[model samples]
Target: MNPLPQNMENALTGSQSSHASLRDVHSINPTQLMARIESYEGREKKGISDVRRTFCLFVTFDLLFVTLLWIIELNVNGGIENTLEKEVVQYDYYSSYFDIFLLAVFRFKVLILAYAVCRLRHWWAIALTTAVTSAFLLAKVILSKLFSQGAFGYVLPIISFILAWIETWFLDFKVLPQEAEEENRLLIVQDASERAALIPGGLSDGQFYSPPESEAV
Candidate 1:
């Protein structure tokens, strides 16, 4: 083959130099990587504001409801008397104490849920609070059935459990989309950076450039 023309040889040499420069810039600096991570976290923080507010409201309402139940339990008679098959069944001192303890535990759990809401805990933390509340509600329901208690005793806890789950679902719904969007945005940025690294003169002054419109087509 004939030797390349002088201009063509110079052009090829410049392109090689540019390619090497681009490669050097393509490896993201620690500062830039930290900035991107912080940006992603900021996006996540902004996206969850509504969810946090909603969860706070839910926890507050739940706290109020539990407080009301606790107050009512405190005022009620020491024991419950139920009639079954014309026979009266009575719950004694130990039974009343057990019921009181159960209510106290439920109230404490509600307080914990409120604290988690205030702290803006992770989804798993919220889920765990909800799970604990649900388990307590289920236990109450089982105890009510075993004691042949009225459905009135079952209503509040069941309602609270259902509402807790609904709130959790709303929180997940609000947060998951934002998380996915952030991930996708980061991926696009990373892919663009990689592509820019492969192009001659793409990284000049430590900045990557997209192809021109005409060149892209």
Candidate 2:
């Protein structure tokens, strides 16, 4: 008989152990254990790429909506009013609504910045947060002077700050990588444990067969 490869031997042992475990599992609490395992596997299947893609789609749709609003604000007005009477009517209706649209645009940008901040890696969050917060603060100061409108200038920053806190506190936006790392570590540990269970031991003969150890440099 041909000698089995070390990996093949290990796999055979593991399969036997797993079959035995399944029998024991079925004898005990089969339903609850199977359900828990299925749930964990499903969550792991969702993965990081799926999450990133979903976030990207949301950001793209929001940007497109903001662009549509801008088009409506600029094109639908026909023309600026020449007469004082026409100007008053236009300002009251079109101008006021257009200002609100601009405010919406500001809000959209802030929301994007907040999203970028949240998605930053563990080490990158500090720099990303600092940059975004500073830019929002500076934009508020400059736009407040240039536009001379308090609502248009400050609304974005105020909303951004609130959203930043929510991301940090509720969503764990900053800590996702850390959580993922810990999850991967747990998986490694579990895999190692399962592999260890497959090792052969307690032979009757004086001679022993064991898995080879890797040589250290």
Q: Candidates' lDDT values, in order?
A: 0.54, 0.46
Q: Could you tell me how far off, in angstroms, the CA of residue 160 lies in candidate 1 after the best superposition?
A: 2.2
Highest TM-score model number: 1
Q: In candidate 2, which residue ranges exceed 4 Å CA deviation? A: 1-38, 48-130, 169-217
TM-score of each: 0.43, 0.36
lDDT of 2 by residue, 119-171 (tens): 43343443354356556555554544423433433443454444434434422
**Residue 17's lDDT in candidate 1:** 81
Cα RMSD for candidate 1? Answer: 10.1
